[model samples]
Structure formats: C-alpha cells, structure tokens
Target: MLGVKKIGWSVLLSLFVLVACSANEKEQSVSQNDGGLQVTFTTPKKVEAGKKTEYTVHVSRNGNPVADAEVIVHLEMADMDHGLNGFRGKMTESGVYKGQAVLPMGGDWIAYVKVKRGSEKVTKRFEFKAEGGMMSPEELEKSGLHENGSLKNPDF
Candidate 1:
C-alpha cells in the first residue's frame, strides 16, 4: 500500500510539471478592439533580452483588413525606464505588419502599438517577459562596462 501511494504521488507531480512547461511554450497573443478596429498582436513564446525578436500585428476594420496604415511599436520596461525603444512596422501582407526590436534587459516589458490610417488611429498595449541573454553592443557601451563583465571606471 505504501509503495502504491508513492507511485501515485510521483505521477501526479510529473504531470503538473509537464503542464506548466507546456503552458510556458505557447505563443502569447493578444487581441483588442477599439473604434471599430480590431488588432491582434502575436509574439514568440520565449523572448531573449538583447536579441532581435520579430513582432507581428494584424489590423482590421469591420472584418476587412486595413492595408494602408502605419504601424509603430514602442518597447518599454515595466519595472524600470530604459529610454525610448521604438520601431516602425512594415506591411508584410494585407493587414499584417511585422517589425523587429531588441529587448534591453530581462524583465517585464510593455509594447505600445499605434496604428494610423488616414484620419483614424488605434493603439494597444501588450505586456510580456523576456529571458536573460547576452548584452548587446549598445547596451554594453551605455553601461560603461567591458564585454568581459568588468567595470570601466574602477575608481568608482
């Protein structure tokens, strides 16, 4: 009886871990509707800091794609300020816009997407987390730290 109970508990714990990991691997997508316009944003399941990640946005009005619109995405750290990190998205297909942006650090982030067409405009926000990765060249320079992870100003 004791052996059976241990086996049952082990199986349950294994299942729980599997479920959690699978959930984390699923893509993160968000949809919003504002002023008769619907926007869907899709991102990868895992985003690494300091690496360029492609972001996709789909915009539609009354079930029809909004093709001739300007799309801009601004990435900001939710817990801290890292300056303005903005990029313009180009239309890859009807109503689909794609762009790339490098996350500055590993932490919670918010992406503010703005779409403009003629006199109409729409904006949406999506929040996500980025995993830690190697620092980019620009980030290294701004931090005044050497690539070897040493401080340039040793006196300080």
Candidate 2:
C-alpha cells in the first residue's frame, strides 16, 4: 500500500509540472470579439528578438469580412517599460491585415491591435514571448528605434 501511494504521488507531481509548463508556452494566435466585431491575431510560433517578424490580424463583423477598416499593431514589453512600438498594418485582402515588428528583446511582450472603421473602433490585446538573444535597455535606446511614450514612427 505504501509503494502504491508513492507511485501515485509521483505521477500526480509529474502531471502537474507538465501542465504548468504547457500553460506558459506562447500561443501563436488568439481571437476575441467586441460588440459585433471579431478579431483574430496571429504570429509565428516562435518570434525571435531583434528580427522583423510578420503579424496578421483578421477582422470580421457578423461573420462577414471587414475590408475597409484601418488596422495598427502596437507592441510593448509586458514586464518592463519599453515605451510603445507601433506598426501600421496594410490590408492584404478582405478582413486580413499584415504588419511587421522587430522585438527589442527576448521576453514577455504584448501586441495590441487597433481596428477602426468610420466611428466604430475596437482594440484587442495578445500576449506572447520572443525568443533568442536579449538586449539591455541602453542598447535598445542606442538602436535609435526605441520610442519614449507614444509611437515615434507608425510607418515602422
């Protein structure tokens, strides 16, 4: 009976660790709905730091694609104050907008996608991780790419 109980506890511990690790893994895509608008944001399974990566956002309303909306993606470090990085998304097709961002470092980051059509506007936030090498705050500042507060270059 003692041996059986030990084995059971070991299995439970292993399962708990597995679940915790999986929960921390970054999601490649996330979807959310506000009012009647639905937005789906997608990124690469693994985003590398200091590399330009493509981001995609799909906007729809009432199950129909929204092709006439302006879309923009803003990125910021989740744990630290990295200012605000903005990327203007260009519509590639109906309901699909694509943009690129170069993450400053490898860590937790949030992407906020803003969609606007006429007077209707909605914003969605997605959290993900960037892998690869890390950079110091000083280096990021010297890179001449980091902004202070608001978006310095929307075209970037």
Candidate 3:
C-alpha cells in the first residue's frame, strides 16, 4: 500500500510540473511580443543645435540579431522648425543599423523610436537638451548652437 501511495504522489508531482512549465512558456511568449524590438541611441545623450550627430539602432529577438526589422526615429525640439525623422537603414555587412540627425534648436528635444516586428510594435522615447548659442567653430565645439535658439519650424 505504501508503494502504491508513493507512485501516485510521484505521478501527481510530475503532472504539476508539466502544467506549470507549459503555462510559463506561454507567458514568456506573450511578454516578448509586448516588449517588441529594443532600441538604443548612440549619439551624445545631449547636444546643441546644428551639430551633426550619429545614431544607431539595434534590433534583436531572443538575444539574437533580428534582420530586416524597421526602426523609426523622431527628434522633437520646441525651438526647431519642423522636427527630424528617419528610418533605420538595412543591416550592413557588419550586422547593425544606423541613422543620423542634426538638432535645430536649443530647448529640450525628445527622441522617439518606434520599432515594428511583423505584427508586434514597440515604442520608446528619450529626452535631451540642445543648447543655443553662437560661437566660432572652436567655441561651437566647446559650447552650443547660436543664441537665436530653435526656429520653431511649423512643418514639424
């Protein structure tokens, strides 16, 4: 009788573990879909207007590179005319994506990234300061953009 009781308990334990594992797998898949594509910006976290900055975006899934994904970046500045926007280029031979932008004003600018993977979508936003001021190339390197600040371009 003891032997039968042990076997029954063992079988019940195994069944519980199997059910828990199945549920965990489903939950993980759902979370991954919610996270969408991850995004990162390579340029200086803060910048001055009119200074060219380089940006890069990386797309991946399950810790492996996800090729052919689309990444959209937008820069919204209160002082600038219209905002800046661009799409991440296709993966180069090196296997990463890149984009570029020049901020046009000195106020706070918001960098927004929207990543789309098949039916899933992910969005992220980052804020940075674009200084406004006028100076020689040397001064510009040390300080920020001209004093006029952003143009507040309505087209944005």
Highest TM-score scorer: 2
Model 1 scores a TM of 0.71
Q: Candidate 1 overall Cα lDDT vs. reference?
A: 0.72
Candidate 1, clashing residue pairs? none
Can you write out model 2's per-residue Cα lDDT over 1-156, one digit (the tens) per residue?
125774465346445544553576664799999767899999886676667789999999888999989998888877666666758888999999998777765566788898999998888999876664444456555544553323345564
Question: What is the TM-score (0 to 1) of candidate 3?
Answer: 0.52
Writing each residue's lDDT as its tens digit, candidate 3 over 1-156 gives 125774465346445545544453321111122354555544454444566666666666656677776767776753344423434455563326676555543445566767766887787776545444322344433433323222222122
Overlapping backbone residue pairs in candidate 1 total 0
Which residues of candidate 1, in runs, are more than 4 Å off? Answer: 1-23, 133-156
* Regions of model 3 farther than 4 Å from truth: 1-34, 78-81, 84-90, 93-95, 134-156
Clashing pairs in 3: 79-150, 79-152, 80-152, 80-153, 81-153, 82-156, 133-145, 133-146
| C-alpha lDDT of residue 21 in model 3 | 46
Tens digit per residue, CA lDDT, model 1, 26-112? 777888997677988888887766666898999998889999798888777675555567568889999999987666556567889
Q: For each candidate, give its TM-score against the true structure.
A: 0.71, 0.73, 0.52
RMSD of each: 11.7, 10.6, 22.1
